[model samples]
Structure formats: structure tokens, C-alpha cells
Target: MSMKHLKYCPELNQITGSINATILLLQLEYWFAKMTGGKFYKFLDSCEHELYKQGDSWVEELGFSKQEFRTAFSKIGKVYTSKKAFKESKDLFNGKYYASYYDRIKGLTYYIRNDAKLSELFDDDSNKILYSEEKSTENTEDVLRTPQIIIPANPKTSSPLSVEYNKLLTSVKDTHPTKVCVPYETIKALFNQYCPSYPQLTLLTAKRKTLLKKLWYDMGQTLENFKQAFLSAENSDFLSGRLGSWRASFDWLIQEDKFVALLEGCYTNNRRQSQFSPSTPSAPKPHSKFTTMYSHYWDFEELEKLEDQYIDRQIAKYSTMSVALD
Candidate 1:
């Protein structure tokens, strides 16, 4: 009970009342948000500095044939002091918490590019194959129609992402294939990630969902229509590159007397990845506040975009409902 950082508790049963969960989460969120301010991006910059330094400091110590860099970075990140303050977003694109936090998590699992140059200048093309999804670059923003949605103060209390996400992965009614949308349930995994030090039910409420559901039309259609809305969500997203993963990993860092680098086992040849964990020994440097702000500008912009998308979704839902009733 000294203070739990991030711990997983499989046996931690889901809360019975959504209201109870919502209230509890609201309390925790108050503190978490307070510590993670508008300057969240600056925090990511600091994380990068640490990753770069740690990677280099422990490269020789790891002694892997390929020279494991993430492990070193993870070890250092796990012990860093900041992990005790910020809480990470469970899903980066759910349009909830900052995107940079989400990017940090994916960076640990997938070696995504921050910029094009991060790709290797390999002597042979055969050596540089990454089984990544083919990125579609067509700007569909023009074809976009305003989507309708119900927004409550908190998605956790208002929507159950766990329930909705599970269904989205399955085949929807065969008749409706033209559109696809994400519901609150699909995003539950993010909210309920196990904090290894002390895992428990978040206890968020469903009132937000109830309010939106009544104010809006067919919730299913709202989610379905969102397919287009969310296409570039993870891409152009403020959390798109360095800040994304940096933030998420940083989120895991907060709340712990000791931090564990979840990315310790990850490997990447990407230059940004390498730079963040440069495999050299150097002392940590004091970060300039401006540098931190620069890294997170996208976060502020992304959150605004999400707010816009939510309003648009509500509009779309309104139209569809009227037509159906007519």
C-alpha cells in the first residue's frame, strides 16, 4: 500500500455498478490529469532523452548479438522518477488522453517511423523488409461527412469499450457493410490495462453513455460511420511518432517507486528508435521546457480534432435517426 504504480490484476473483478466505477475513476483522474498538464509533450521529450542515454549506457552490458537497445532503455525508464505521476491512455486513438502516450506503447511493440529518414539506408533491399500494413495516403478528408455521436464527460463511465470492441472484431449484421464505426466497448482494453503494482477495477460510470445514447440516434450507426473519421486517427494523430510511444511508456512510468520498461524486449533499427536509445554511455541532460513543448504541440491539436469529430458524429447520428423515423 506504499503506492501502486502500474500492476496487473487478472483477478480484479469488474466493478458491479458503473456509477461506482465512474466516481472512483473521476477521483483518480483528477490527480492524474493535474500532474499531466498541457505540457505533456515536454514530458515525452524528457523520455526520449532518458531512452537515448540508457540505451547507450547499457549496450555493452546487454551484450546481445544484435545489441539489445530497448531492454536497456526499458530498464532505465522503469527506474526513472517521472513514472509516478502520469497515467497512460489505454488506446491511443480513442480520442481520450494524449496521443503521444499511445505512440510510446506501440513503439515498444512495432518499430513505426517518426519520419521517413528513420528507414534504413540498407546496402541490400532484401535485408530491410518490414511486414507493416500498406499505408494508404489518399486524403479522404474531402469525402468526409460529419458523423454523429453522443459524448459524455467520460467515455469510461458513459461507454463500455470492453463490450463494444469485442463485437466490432466480429462480423456485424451482413446487411450493413458500407459503414464501420467504433463504439465505447472496443476501447475498453485501454482503460483497464493492468497496473502491475496494484491492479483494480477502474469503477467508471455508464451515465455518460446513457446521456449520449438518449440525446443521439442509433448508437450503432454512429460507431459505424466513424470508420472514415478514424482512418488517420492513429497516423496524423498528434501521438503519431516519437511523442506517442514516449507518452504511453511514460504513463506506465508514473505511479511507481520502481519502473519496468515494457519495451525491454522490443527491438528496432529505425533511426528515431536508435536515437531515443542510442546504445552509448552519456549522462542525463536537463531538458529545456521549450523542447518539451515542441514535442507535444500535436497533442493539443489532436485533442481539439477529437472534440470536433465528436460534434460531427453527433450531427451525423442526428441525420440518420430522422431519416429512419421518416
Candidate 2:
């Protein structure tokens, strides 16, 4: 099963507990940035908040004590520069007594995007584990063989799926809906990309089709938004796990609040703006007028009592009129 956090690292297999905790802590930091649409530099910023405590909680969840967590971070400088766990790259940040910057503001991003180690952990099958060399060969072949269709440079204006979407769909699902005569190949491609272990979507199930339709028409998210969210989830350690693996999924992501939350960078270091502060900002909120203004103010309990009395009076008047007529 896919894990929301990296529970095991081959490098930490035979390391001291302190070193293991340190490496795990670093991975947790990376995972935090991945979930949020922000960079890891935010973690190293001067701003102080509960982010460290949150990391501690994760360490505790991973079967380490809070003291160990604290000690790991405290000793990070000594251990990291010692060339113990990860070898220091030639790239250096001009800080006193520091070699490679732990923040890795740009280098980490470059690696995650380019380095094979950070990208795909296991194959799609979830059964077989391929070595880095073998995986690289397969990836190269897949790229060369994939159809070189040019995705529109400005997909937002065109409101169309990206080249990545087209390649993913043609490779996997490739469904064409007959009833609507409007093929939703884009949605199919997203589902396939989001959940590759599922059977190829030659046809979408009724439930799946309705969900896709509402996500597009009701939610009003374009194919580009879908593509971006898919990539975000793909990189997130918490969301890309297979269904029933305690990680978020495509369906969860499509929810109104969840989609907006992901897009807003709630999970990322961009959330520093919402951190605890001495005084809260008085920014005007959306729909504030709706909450502030009301045409009439009636006490709910009084209104209910008045309504019941009016109903009784009407019944009595109707009874008297019937008697008089009789």
C-alpha cells in the first residue's frame, strides 16, 4: 500500500536512532511542502508557529519520542555537515558553518522535478519494484513512444485538456460517450492519471460519469484546473496513495471545499499568512454584507409561536363560517 508519509528509508535502515529521526524529519518537511502548493523555504523562515510542533507530532506518529524529535533538529547542523546521512552537494549557501542549505529552496525543487529518486517510488502495478536504472530506461522509452501532440500553449483560454492529458488518455482509458455525443476524454484521462491501478476506462461507470459531469459543469473547474490538481496530488505523499490506503483520492479532491483548499495552497508553506499572530488582520471578507444585513429581524421562537396562533385563529374562523352556512 502507498504511504502518506515515507515510513521507511533504505538509508536509515542501519543508522543511529538520532540520525534516522533527523532524516525522517527532513522527509516530513518535504512532504509538508508537497501537499501545499508552496516551497520549503517557508519552513526555514524567521516566522515562528506550530509548524515545528506539527512535525514533532508526525515524528511521534512514526513511533519516535518528542525528545528524540527535538534532539534530532537540535543536532541537525552537526550531523548534516558531518557527511553522515546525505552527502553535501557542491552547491553551498553563504551561511556561517553551513554547507548545503537544508531549505534547498531551488535545488530541492529541481531534484523533485528532475531527479528520479523523488518522483515515482514504485511502479503502477504496485507489485513490482524497479531499480533506478531500469525505471530510467522505461521512462525514456515511454517519452519517445508517447505521441508528440502539441498541447495549446494557453489551455485556459481554449478550455481544453493539456498535451499530458491527451497522452495519458490515449495510453490508458480512451473513452467516448455515445449518449451525450460529447466525449469527455479529458475527465477520463484525469481519472486514469489520478488512479492508474483501476481498470482501463473504455467506458465510465454511471456513478463515475455523473461525478465527472458535476465536477466539470457544477464545480466549473476547467481541464487545466483538473490537470494542475492531478499533478499536485501526484506529488503529494498524502494524496497519491491507492484508495483504502489512508490517503486522499481523486474523488476527495473533487469535493467543493477540498478542491478550493488544494488550489489555495492550504497544505503548503504558503499557509504562513494564516499563522497565529499578535493581532488578526481586518481584511474584508467575501459575502460579509449577507451576514451583516437583514431585511427584518424576528425572534425565531416568537415567530414559531405566532405562526401556531395564526393557524388556530384561521381554523376557528373557518369552523364558524361552516356552521353559519349550515
Candidate 3:
């Protein structure tokens, strides 16, 4: 029976605790207030709100009580940094400092609860004893090497499976769907160039195939996802690398106060005229060419409606334009 055990994830614990300690402490305070009828076990309030008012400035000028603050801080720090000793130690009835909502006695019995000793530190032994081991489920890597590797699938045979199998495939798992095998030559090349420290034999065809399948499968998925995303983009040309620095093409012009005639013509249109015509009849805003080509492309139909609604005024104004008569 395979079993798994919980070990401290040190990096995660350090990061989470450092950033969330203030929030956790406040939660503890709220719980304490509810459990103990709005009373705080910690003797003094934090300097900011309860004890001192803001903008007084003289409050900070009055100076800190080093002995009192240090005594309280040490009690809390020990609970965080030293878990083993803390879980095993006995609690004192009149400990000088205490964490908020901390249990003083177990199940309301007078017997002291180790969890509450204000100055106590948690030790390693107690933590080790408290943690329990659990069984783990089979994962992809494990499934790949068990039943398949048990009876060395005849690597020497050149059956349909045989052609795909090299000397290295004798140890793959039955759950593995692929008949493909890693050639001995690829393993030899990589081992020589990258991992000479380990015995070259360890990268035998079997192990190499397993490692390569995982690495290649993951890379293929990521690459395919990126391709799909780029394909779905509104500006397909930019993603396919056709408009190379077409993004930066305008940066120099704008920065140097220069303008291209083509861009200006596009923005102003060929005739420097507004597309709206009072008598010619107006479609809904969503259908407007300016909105479609210039503003963020809303659905063309929706743009027509918005334009029409805004243009439908009780008082309409008419304007004239010069048309070239040939």
C-alpha cells in the first residue's frame, strides 16, 4: 500500500504568513470580541486607534514603552516561529502576553490548554505528531511505467508493436497509449551534451521515452494554445508577424511631430467631408463607416442603431457640400 505524508511547504508558508499576518490578527481579534463579550485578552490596544488619536503627533513624540512592547511581541513571534515546543508545552494561568481568541483551557476544564501560553513557542515534535499521513492516487507518470514495464514487452520482436519499439521500450506502462519508442541514439546525444555527471546508462531508451513524452506533450499543448489565441485575435496580421514593427511604425512619426499623408487622408477621408446627410436619410449609428473603421469596432448593426438614435433630433439642421461636376 503506497502512502503519502504532508511536509511543510516552507516557501509557500513563509510568503502567505508574512503578507497575511495583519489580516489574520484582526480576524482573531473579532473572534475574541464575540467569544469573550467584547473583551480583549491582550492587555493594551494597538497605538493607532484605541490608545492614541491621529494628527496629535505628540502621541508618537511621547515615546514607546520598549519593555512592554517587546514582551508582548516575543510571545506572538514564538507561536509563529516555534511550533513543536509550543504544542508540547503546558500553559500558565497568568502569562504576561496572549494572542487574541486563544483557548486557555481544554473543553472548559481547569486543566491548562497548551495552545494559549502567551509566551510559549511551538516545538517540532508536537507538530510532527499532529500531522497525519495519507494515501495518494495514481498519476500519469506512475500509470505509464507499472503494468507496461512488468513483463519486458519483447523489444526484439518486429511485430506491428515491434517496429515502433526500440531496445528502450521494454519498460513502458500498459496505460501508455502510444506505440512510439525513443531511439537509443537521441538519449546518447542528450546525455553526452547535457547530463554527463550521471551515468549515461540511466538515460536508456525506456527512461528517455518517458521523459520526452511528458516534455513534448506539454510543449505541444502550450504552442497549440498560443497559435489558437493568435488566430482568434482581431488583428491577425500582427500576430502572424506580417506587420512587423507596424506597431512601432507610428511611434517615431508621432514623437517627432511628423504625419504621413496616407494616415491623415484615412482619418479625414478623401474629401474632408462628414459622412452624414440630413436629407439623404441616416441609418442607425452601428452602421456608420466612421465607427466601423475608426472607433472600436462595435457590431456594424449595433453602430447603425446608435447613430440613428442620436441623429433622430426634433430639430434637424441641413448642410451643403461641393460636388465636382464633370
The TM-scores, one per candidate, come to 0.16, 0.24, 0.14
2 or 3: which has the higher lDDT? Answer: 2
Top lDDT prediction, candidate number = 2
- Clash-forming residue pairs, model 2: 36-267, 36-268
lDDT of 3 at 121: 33
Residue 40 Cα positional deviation in candidate 2, in Å, after optimal superposition:
29
RMSD to truth, every model: 25.5, 28.9, 31.4
CA lDDT for candidate 1: 0.26
Candidate 2 global TM-score: 0.24
Q: Per-residue lDDT tens digits of candidate 1, residues 1-326?
A: 11111111111114212222222222222223334222222222213443343323222212221212322222212212221112232222231211122233322211111111112221244122211122334342211111121112222343323566425412221233333333445323332322211232243246533432321222233432222212212212122232333323212322121111212211221222212211222213324423434233467667756744553454345435545654
In the range 90-178, model 2's lDDT, one tens digit per residue, is: 22211111122222222121111111222232235421221112223343312211111212222234324466744642442223243
Q: Which regions in candidate 2 have their CA more than 4 angstroms from the true location?
A: 1-183, 194-203, 219-221, 242-245, 268-326
* Whole-model lDDT per candidate: 0.26, 0.38, 0.28
Q: Alpha-carbon error at 17 in model 3, in Å? A: 39
